[model samples]
Target: MTAASPPSASRPRYAVYVVLVLMVAYMLSFMDRVLISLMIDPIRTELGLGDTQVGLLVGFGFVLLYSIMGIPFGAIADSGNRRNLMVGGVLGWSAATAVSGFAGGFISLLAARAMVGIGEATLSPAAYSTIADRFEKRKLGFAVSLYNMGVSLGGGVAMLFGGVLVAWAMATAVPLPWGELTGWRLAFVAVGLLGVPLAAVMLLTVREAPRRQGGIKPPPLSALWALAMRHKAAFAAVVIGYSILVIAAYGAMLWAPVHFARAHGMSPAHLGLAFGVIIGLFGTVGLAIGGLLSDRSAKRGHPDAPVRIVLASAVLQFPLMMGAYLASDTTVALVLAAAGMATVSTIGGLQAGTLQILTPASMRGRMTAIYLLVANMAGMGLGPLVTGFVSEHLFDGPTSLGKALALVTAVSLTIGVALLLLARKAIIAAVLDNDRAEAEAG
Candidate 1:
C-alpha cells in the first residue's frame, strides 16, 4: 500500500483568519436572529399584538423556513463553493432584514423574518464543514468552540449595543433617505445592511476547503439517509438531546429580556447590558472551558469526550436555569442566568465538533443540515412559542414569564441529560468504526 500523504503546511495564520471571519458571520446571523427579542415590547405595543404572536414571530416564522431549507443548503455546501453560498446567503438575509424595517404589519414582518431564517440557514453547515477541514482532530474542539463564540458575541452585541442603538433611534428619530423610521424599524434596517459589505469581504478572502471526498460527488439524499439509518441510535440521541436542550435555551434567550422588563422593570438599555454580560462574557468562558476540556480529553484517548463534556454542562445547567427563573430578586435572577448561560454555551461548539468527528468529511454538511433541521425546528421553533403559550394561556399574565420559563427548562433539560448519557456508547462505537475504516483505506 502507498504511504499516506504528508499533511498540508498551510500557515496557522490563515486558519485563524478564516475562523475569525466565520465567527463574525455567525455573530451577525445571531444578532439578526435575537434582535427581535429586545424589540418585543415596542413591536407589540405598536402592532396591538400579544405574546403568542410575538412568539410566532421570534420562533416559528424564521425557524420553519430555516429548518426546511437547511437540508438542501447543507447538500449544496457539501459540494458547492461554500464561500459563494455564504455570500449569497448573507446578502439575502441582510436584505430581508432591511425589508423588515418596512413592514406594515405582523404578516409582512413575519415574512421578512422568515426570509432572514432562510439566509441564515446557509451559514452553519458550510462554516462547520469548512472549519472541520481546516483544523485537525485534536484541535477541532477548540477551533469550533472559538467559532461558536459568535453565539455569545453576537448575542452580547445585540443586547449591549442593540439596546443603545434602539434607545438612540427612539430618542433622536434620526432621519434617513427612507424617511424617519422608528427605532425598532431602524434597527432592523441598520443591522441588516451591515451584512452586505461583510459578505463581499468573505467572498474576496475565504476559500473552500479541499473536499475530503474529492472526485466523488456528494451523495444524494437517499444515500445520506441510508448512512444516517446505519447509526440510528446515535443520531437519535444527538438530535433529540440537543433539541431538548435548545428548547430551554432558546425559550429563555428570546424571553429573558421581556422577563426582566416585566419582573424587574428595567429599561431596554439596562436589560441589554445585563443580559449582554450574562450571555456574552459568561458564555465565552464556558465555551473556552468546554473546548479545552474536550480537546484534552480527546488527546488523552477519550473517545466520548465531547458528549461527556456536554452532559456535564447539562448537569450544571439544570440548577442554574431553575434558580434563574425562580429567584425573586432581580440581581439573584441575573446571577443565576449568567451561570446558566455559561453552561449552555458549551452545547453548540462541543456538539458540532462531536458531529464532525463522527461523520465522514464528505457527509459533514448534510449531517449538519439534518442536525440543524431537527434541532432548530424542535428547540428554536417550538421553544419560544410554547413558553409564550404557557404565558398567555396557562398563566394569563405577563408576570407569569418566570414560571413558564422554569417549566420548559425543568422538563426539557431532564430529558436531555438522559438522552445524552444513552448516546455515549453509540458515539464511542462510531468513533472506533470510523477509525478502523480510515486505517483500512490508508
Candidate 2:
C-alpha cells in the first residue's frame, strides 16, 4: 500500500475559521457553565439553601458526568466526525441550560446541570484533536492560546451579562419568565439560549478534517494506556499538576463574587463587573503572552518551554492568590485577583501544546481524554467542593472564606510548581523523542 500524502503542504487558511468556530462553541460552553456562579446568592436565598448545596450544584453535580463521559467522547473524537460531535455537544448543553431555567427545585436544577456536564464533555477533546490535526506544531501553542481565550471571555460574559440581567430584573420588577424563576435561573436561560446560535454556526460551517491522513487506525485504548504507563512521570505530572491548578482556579471562580460581595460589601453588579473585566482582560493577555513565549522558546530549541512557563507562572501565583485573599481593600483585592488569574491562566495554552507534541495524531484524543478525566475529576470535581466545605465547616463563617480560600490556593500553587518542575525533564525528553521519530519517518 502506498503512503498517504502528508496533508497538503500549503496550510489551510480555513484553519483559522475552524479555530474561530471552536472558540465560539467553547465560549458558550463556559458561559452556560459559569452563569450559575453569578446567580448563586439569589438562588440560595430563593431556594433556602446553603453554601454546601450551591457548591454541590456547581461542583460535583456538573463534574461527575462531565469527567466520566469525557474519556469516551475523546476516544470517539479520535475516530469519528469531530465537527458533528462538537455541534451535537453544543446543542445538548444548550438545551440542558434552557431546561435549567425552568427547574422548580434543588433536585431538578442539579439534574439540568449534570446534563450540561454530559454535553460539554464532548467539546474539548474533539476541538483539541481537530486543532492538532489542522495546525503545524510550531503554531500549535499560539493557536491553543487563542482558543483558550474563550474561557476567559466566556467567563466574563457570564458574569457581566448575568449581572446585567439580574439588575434588569430587579430594576424593572418584571415578573421572571416563570413565576418562580428569579435570579440564577434567569441567568441560566439567557446564557443557555446563546448556545443555539453558536451551535447552528458550528453545524453549518465547520467541516471535520480527515482523520488519520496516513491510513493509520485510531490507537486502541490499550495503546493509550501503555503510552501513559511508559511515560508515567510525564503523564502523571501533567495531569496532576494541571488538576491541582484547576482546583484553585475553579474554587476561586466559584467563590470570587461571593467573597467580594460579602467581604467588601460590594453590590452584585459591581462585583460581577470587577471580576469580569479583570479576568476577561488580564486573563486573555496573559494567555496570549504565554503562548507567544512558549512558541518562541520551542523554536529556540527548548521543547519544555511551555512547561517552564507554567512552572514560573505557578511560582508567581502562590503569592498573588494569597494577596487576593488577604487584601482588605476591594481595589487591592481585585488587582491581586487579576494578577493571580493572569499568572495561573498562562498555563492554559502550554498544557494543550505539550499534550499534542507528546502524543501521536491517532492517540491525541484518547490521551486528551485521560488528561481531562484526571484534570476535571480533581479540579472541577473537588476544587469548589473542597473550598465550600472548608469555608462552611472548617472556617464556619463568611469572614473566614477569603482566608480559607487563600490558604488552599497557596498550597495548591506550591504543589503545582513542584510537579511542573519535576515534569520539565520528562516533557523535554518526550518532545525530543517525538522530533527524532518524525525526522526518521520523514
Candidate 3:
C-alpha cells in the first residue's frame, strides 16, 4: 500500500480562523444544549411540573434524538458539504431555541429541546472530520482541544449567563413584546438568536479542507462498517466509557445550581457564577493540558496515553466528587467540585484524537456519530435523569440530593475506570497499528 503523504510542515494562519469559527459554533451548540439547566426551576414552576419531568426534558428529551440522529448526519457529513451541514445545524438549533421561549407547556418545551438536539447532532462528527482534514496528526490534538473548549466555555457561559439572564428577567417584570413570555423564555430567545449570525459567519468563513491525498476512495458506508468491525472493542469501550462519564458530568452540571441553592441557601445567580468560573477556567485548562500531554506521549510512542489519562482521571475523580458531595462547607465543596471538573474534562481531547487516529479519514464522521450516539444516549441522556431519579426516590429529600448525585457519579466513574482499564491494551494496539499503517502508506 502506498503511504499517505505527510501534511504541510508549517500550519497556516487560516487554521486559526478555522479553529475560532469551530469554537464559536461549538460554544453555541453547547449553550443551546445546556442553558435549559439554569432555567429549570422557572420552567418547572411555570409548567407545574416535577423534577422527574425537568430531568426528562433536560436529559432524555434532548439527548435521545441528538444521539440517534448523529450517525446519519455524520455519514452525510463525510460525503456532503460540511460547511452547509454546520450552518444548517446552527440555524435549526437556533430557531428551536427561539421557539423554546414561546413554549406554553411541557410538550412544546420537549419538542423545542428535541429540535435543539437534532441541530446539534450534525456538529461533532463533521467538525472532527474537518479538523482532521485540516491539521496534521501531530497538531490534531491541540486543534481538537481548542474546539472542545466550547464544552467548557459553553457550560460556563450557560451557567453564568443563564443565572444573570434569569435574574435580570425576574427583576425586570416586563411583559414580552409578543405576549406573557417569562425570563426563561427570553433567555432562550436571546441565546437562540445569537446562533443566526454565527451561522452566517461560519458559512462565509470556514472552508472544508481538501480530503487526504492518494488513498483509494473506499465506499463510504462499507468503509464505515468495516472500520467499526475492525475496532469494535475500542469503539465500544469509548462509547460506553464516554457515555458514562458524560452522564456524570451533565448530571452534576444540570443539578448543581439547584443543589447549591437548596442545600446551602445560595442564590441562583451566585451559584451560576461560581460554577461557571470553575468549569470555564479549570475545565478549559484541564482539556488543554490533557490534549498536549497525550499528544506528547503519543509522539514518544506511548500508544496507551488516551486510556491511561482517562483511567487516571476516573480514579482521581471518584474521591474529589465524593468530597464535593459530602463536604458541609460551601467553599470546600466548590473547590473540590472544581478539581473534579478539571480531572474529568481531560478525556475530551484524548477521546476525539484517539478516534481520529484509529479510523480512516472517510469514516471519521460516521465513527464519531456512532461514538456520540452511545455516549449521548447513556451519558447526556441518562446522567441528569438518573441523578434526579435517585435524588427523588432513593434519597427522599433535598438534604440527600447531594449524596445521591455523589453516589451516582462515583458509581459511574468506577464502572468507567474498569472499562477503560480493560480497553487499554486494545487502545495501545490500535494506535500502534494506525501508526504503522500511516508510516507504510506515506
lDDT of each: 0.85, 0.80, 0.79
lDDT of 2 by residue, 364-406 (tens): 8878888888888777778777788888888755567797788
Candidate 3 residue runs with Cα over 4 Å from true position: 1-11, 173-178, 213-218
Q: Cα deviation in Å at residue 72, candidate 1?
A: 0.9
lDDT of 3 by residue, 273-365 (tens): 887887788888988988888778767877676667767777887888788877889999999989988886787667777788887776788
TM-score of every candidate = 0.96, 0.95, 0.95
TM accuracy, model 2: 0.95
lDDT of candidate 3 vs native? Answer: 0.79
Best-to-worst ranking by lDDT:
1, 2, 3
For candidate 1, report its TM-score.
Answer: 0.96
Error of 2 at 162 (Å): 2.0
Name the regions of candidate 1 deviating beyond 4 angstroms: 1-9, 174-179, 396-398
Which candidate ranks first by TM-score, i.e. highest?
A: 1
Give the distance in Å from residue 417's predicted Cα in candidate 2 to where it truly belongs: 1.5
